[model samples]
Target: MSALPVIDIHTGAAPVLRETVLEFDQVAVQLGGRQILSPTSLKIGRGEFITIIGPSGCGKTTLLRAAAGFVRPEGGAVLRQGRLVGGPSREVAFVFQDYAHALLPWRTVQGNVELALEAAQVPATERAPRAQQVLQTVGLAAHAAKFPAQLSGGMQQRVQIARCLAQQPELMMMDEPFGALDAMTREGLQDELARLVRETGLTVLFVTHDLEEAIYLADRVVALRANPTAERPSLARVIDVNLPRPREQLATKEHPEFLRLRRELYGYLGHGHG
Candidate 1:
């Protein structure tokens, strides 16, 4: 008997040179005497939105961290734009789930965003316009002068996102960014993120435990299994979302494909108990 073929869900658009923005070549990780991730191989094309979903301790965030060069894999390699990733770079921006801690409380919204540009050493004269432009993109232009403590949870997250955008990164690593928000806020931010990614053509690798959220925003969803072995690898499945774009929170979730994907992924994560 032979092993089953790995399912690849593609949007059906041919990529030029099939350009790969990120690749994990048989990557493996161990942390504090535990195997966090087994050897896994994956590729992300330029401008593609790839979401990672799995049960707790399944290495979703670890994978994202490896891509960001925050974690070193014990075996194999991670590549960005075909070059070996050494450490964190300006070209890759990370958005944490805790927006409260991620944003500097004392800094005004614009001031916080300005930090990215300042780190990149953009001339002082050019920083404000760039920050404002990104703030406008994320619908935070009007709140530029407000402090993080003055804003709601969702708006604070937007400020963090705006700061990342100010860096003009080619790739964004988001770890459960909307996980802390209320349902309505999460849905709104999902749509907003989808729009921004479309407009900017930025490649993203998002981590989430929410199956529906994974299917909703991803061009492709990568499902992982925690305890990987030779027979059952860490990369359990790769599902392509064929749902229509500009997805609506109400209508899109009601779509047949959406329901089917939700059910399929639920089996992997055992989602119905709660």
Candidate 2:
């Protein structure tokens, strides 16, 4: 509590906060003439792990896409490292939930991870070592030569993460990345991902429907509300987790603060299917 800057995103937290990595200034979006997000604003600091959760159609994915420059906002703006995010950049890496479609089945694990370096035009010789390093970081070094078809769902997802790491991005956008994994597998990867993000010091904006996942992995949880109006805006609330680092799936989930936050956020999710 003393040194940690787990402060509200929309409020006064800059003094103790790290350098801003991403900023959403009155951001809004619409689809098919319907407003997807209201005028929203949040400042995300470097190395922060922010999780977004809300009901279905609440623009969780839309907000994340906007941050990554994959979606254009109808109003307001998204700034990355003080520059307006007009389009996707090599410094930003996106991790899709569907690992099956995200990875190229024709390529080996190492080859897929090398795609990022290839896109950046890194030398062919440099790509190998970089790809291998990230693969090893994700514990997939032994499976480098294996094809995506040969790996399990969790392993495939790990490859996808490894690929993002190879890009050496300043920000990582994860959209319900563990949503498709089994309960056990999801918990395991949650730990692995938390560890990876900590070690790499990459700022992450993660979207999830799971209440516990949102609480366990976030420095602050941004809860959005669907079908926004002036009375009920899209950005419902942002709560600081304030929990210690290196969260354990079992122990952290059972922590008093964790349970309290879970109970607090459960109401917004409405049966947790969102």
Candidate 3:
């Protein structure tokens, strides 16, 4: 077998066309004789944050999974660093929509994060410190010994993120990770997640139903077509967000470029121009 490809995320110093990290070449997916994703194509550059938005059942999550090797397509290819992906490799980590199912009920927050490292075959002696470091990164250091039952919903999701961070995967695939949280908590974690991505230089492929969330977090947003199983899902044009980095939620949202991007993103999802 050939070596699994390792994708490099661009840190914004060079032009996008010169540093394409992830590419989809006329990719299509189907299940039970019904088409899920249409002939979609995109190239995600290194260090770029991409958010995918659409109505429910629009194959946004499926496309993210395909890139993570969870959903293999019936046609076309997903290339990482210009090489085809065959299966689940260590280079990718997926944060599921359901945090309750994603975390282990019996494991403490630290143990859960440690388990990810163990599964990745990280040595036993190195696991504790690695887990602790990631927990710090996600701002869950105090809850290390606490079980999932002891923490609130948002904290549990942080533990989930810490686990993924512990693995230190090259490409992070998130499927509505904050969808289940309340408004305040959701906003807080959204900022935290953006900070983590920027500080750690991790490339993200996030799937969300919220257009505002897409505008706030993504360097570019890709909108999907609705009713994926009934008809092939399509990719609307990529909306570029060139807002200033290290963005604050309130300030970034208030910016003119942010509003313009939000409006364009909404329109792509079949909303209005005004």
Best by the TM-score measure: 2
Clashing pairs in 3: 9-46, 9-47, 10-46, 10-47
Give one digit per residue, the lDDT tens place, for model 2 in 1-274: 1123445432435546478889999998888988888899998888889999888887888998899998899899999878899998888999999999999999999999999899999999999999988998989999999999999999999999999988899999999999999999999999999999888889999999888899999999999887887567799999988777778878888899998888888865668446
lDDT at position 15, candidate 2: 44
lDDT of each: 0.88, 0.88, 0.83
lDDT of 3 by residue, 1-274 (tens): 1222222223435343435667888888896887889888888877679999887777788899889888888889999888898789878999987888999999999999998899899999999999999999888899899999999999999999899888888889999999999989999999999888878878899988888888889888888877654244477567777777777889989999989887776666675211
Q: Candidate 2 — worst ten consecutive residues by lDDT sum?
A: 1-10
Residue runs of model 2 more than 4 Å from their true location after superposition: 1-15
Candidate 3: where is the Cα deviation over 4 Å?
1-18, 228-233, 271-274
lDDT of 1 by residue, 19-130 (tens): 6788999998888987788889988887788999887877888999999999999999999878889999999999999999999998999999999999999999999999
TM-score between model 3 and native: 0.90
> TM-scores, in order shown?
0.92, 0.93, 0.90
Which is superior by TM-score, 2 or 3?
A: 2
Q: Give the TM-score of candidate 2.
A: 0.93
After superposition on all C-alphas, the RMSD of every candidate to the true structure, in Å, is 4.1, 3.8, 4.1
